[model samples]
Target: MDHRDMRISDAERERVVAQLNTAVAEGRLTIAEFEDRVDGVLRARTFGEIEPYVTDLPVQQVKPPEESELRSRSSSLKRRGRWTVPRRLTIVTLSSSVKLDFTEAIFGAAVVDVVLDAHSSSVELVLPAGAVADVDSIYTHASTVKSRIEPSGGGVQFRISGEVSTSSVKLRYQRRFWRWRW
Candidate 1:
């Protein structure tokens, strides 16, 4: 028979032989069983002939209707203005330490400002005054930063910091669950 007409690549046959040898070495199959399986793989005339050996493994399939419906609904909410994109700006500092200053007017109504200080060895976050004003409760999820909402004269400050090479900051609107990160 022509080598090409056999419909089995040399690499594929070698891989099956290796697997059969390993199975016998591991005592999962007797020498007779291993030889039979290896021969079958080598003699496979079409891809279908190898199906029985691979059927037990999981295979990928298209998503079902119920899953597709849920995905469509979730995407529709984003287009309906339920989520707002927060403004993000990146600033580079050359000084050993830097301080950022801002006021409520810098951010429009219901918008919060987030400042990320990215230094060579440290990172810091500063939240605007109105970020969480309307919320009845406040909880922090990240352990890196020591968060504090303190009355500074007539305004409030939310600050967090840690040792970091680069700083990323996000402005979050609690009620809308909208965020802008930089």
Candidate 2:
């Protein structure tokens, strides 16, 4: 997607700069290189402009199984009833704010239904749990979840230093009995 389409916010840019600074301090980037790249990021007006530099930086990796296999398995597993666990989650972000809520109870579990709403700015909906059986299920196939949930609770609030906004979030709860579920 185009950097303009990505709609990254100023706060996110600051965050990226902070991370870059850390990397430089740790010797991951030389002072001169750091200053140059940092300047580039600061000057960047779109996500596309900042992506090439940041995409290569060290980050976590998560990949899903082949789609065919996943679909076939999901279909077969659907018959078992016990093989799948469905949960309902409602996430609400306040005006001009971004939020993420994770429940330890569902940590590493499968998310069947994810509901998201955004009003302004950009929202990032992330599932960092390793226990989730199908990240693609909620993200790609279902499309209920977005790469970044936009700021929807209200308008975006620019904070000078303190908390910029408050996010109201909720996640539904359910458990599957399948032994291999995960």
Candidate 3:
């Protein structure tokens, strides 16, 4: 698909930068070239603007996500590994399970907001090291909420707020390589 005209998210730019870094490590790009592309990516505002920087370099499908929302109804959904984190998200799970792992997520913004709505469901948040989460607005009724991470300054901050009804929500920090742990 031609996505050059689409507006690019900061997370998308970061993703391309990471790909460039890998290319340099693999000897596919020189240090100077990588530096130049990196600069271009950070300054890019549109998809077209960043295409040239990674056109010749290897990359995954760089299409920007339409929006930032994951919903499940009586089913299971998981997000992990090399996914792009949107600027804002709204996740709703209805009597289902949803796990959002941000350890390897490409952050699109320095500050992100996540709204979670759970109903008789389980929601798990696996955060990246040095990332902090604030749940001051989270409210629950007859539910279990456990967090292993205390609010603190970190590389990327996720401001979370939501309502849970008869469900469980847990938050923790996990190593990027550890996917088995919930």
Candidate 4:
């Protein structure tokens, strides 16, 4: 028997479904195509049956980078709008301001690891809805860390770790209008 004849497990089927979801979110597939492919994946029972649904779709395997760093000495660093959020990010600054807005940013992974190293500066993270952050690993001296959003069990999480000396770090959700929280 060929390897393609092997039976497929639910996990394998769900992986394909996740790829299909990403495809639709990236606009690579229309809603109709995504629905059709998801339906096919649900019915697939063998490797051969699942091969065709994603044969033409591009692979979006999330591979985390070793470490990407952004260093600033006297200027402000801002990352906002539809940008790709690195799996591991290191922000180093001195006497500067840093703001990372993830409202429309693309997440390569469910959790983002941010390492902060600042002196006499301020760092702010503007998270989107349904996202939470963990900042317990950060070490602060003569600084303050504040997060308006409560940490939850699931969804997108930010693992913030590092040191902030004479600096501050804050986490807040994106606001819509002056009174709307959307």
For TM-score, candidate 1 versus 4, the one ahead is: 4
**Superposed model 3: Cα runs more than 4 Å off:** 1-67, 175-182
lDDT of 4 by residue, 61-155 (tens): 76546568999898999988667778899999999999988887767788899999999999999987778888899999999999987767555
Model 1 scores a C-alpha lDDT of 0.38
lDDT of 1 by residue, 141-172 (tens): 33133334333333333333222233222323
Each candidate: what lDDT? Answer: 0.38, 0.41, 0.83, 0.87
Q: What is the TM-score of each candidate against the true structure?
A: 0.26, 0.33, 0.64, 0.65
- Scanning candidate 2 in windows of ten residues, the lowest lDDT window is 68-77
TM for candidate 4 is 0.65
Question: Candidate 2 overall Cα lDDT vs. reference?
Answer: 0.41
Worst 10 residues of 4 by lDDT: 59-68
Identify the superior model by TM-score, candidate 2 or candidate 3: 3
- Evaluated at residue 23, the lDDT of candidate 2 is 78
* lDDT (C-alpha) at residue 12 in model 3: 64
Candidate 4 lDDT for residue 146: 94
| RMSD of every prediction | 23.0, 18.4, 9.7, 8.0
lDDT of 3 by residue, 91-172 (tens): 9899999888897787757778889889999999998877888877888899988888866765788788889999998889
Candidate 2 positional error at 114, Å: 24
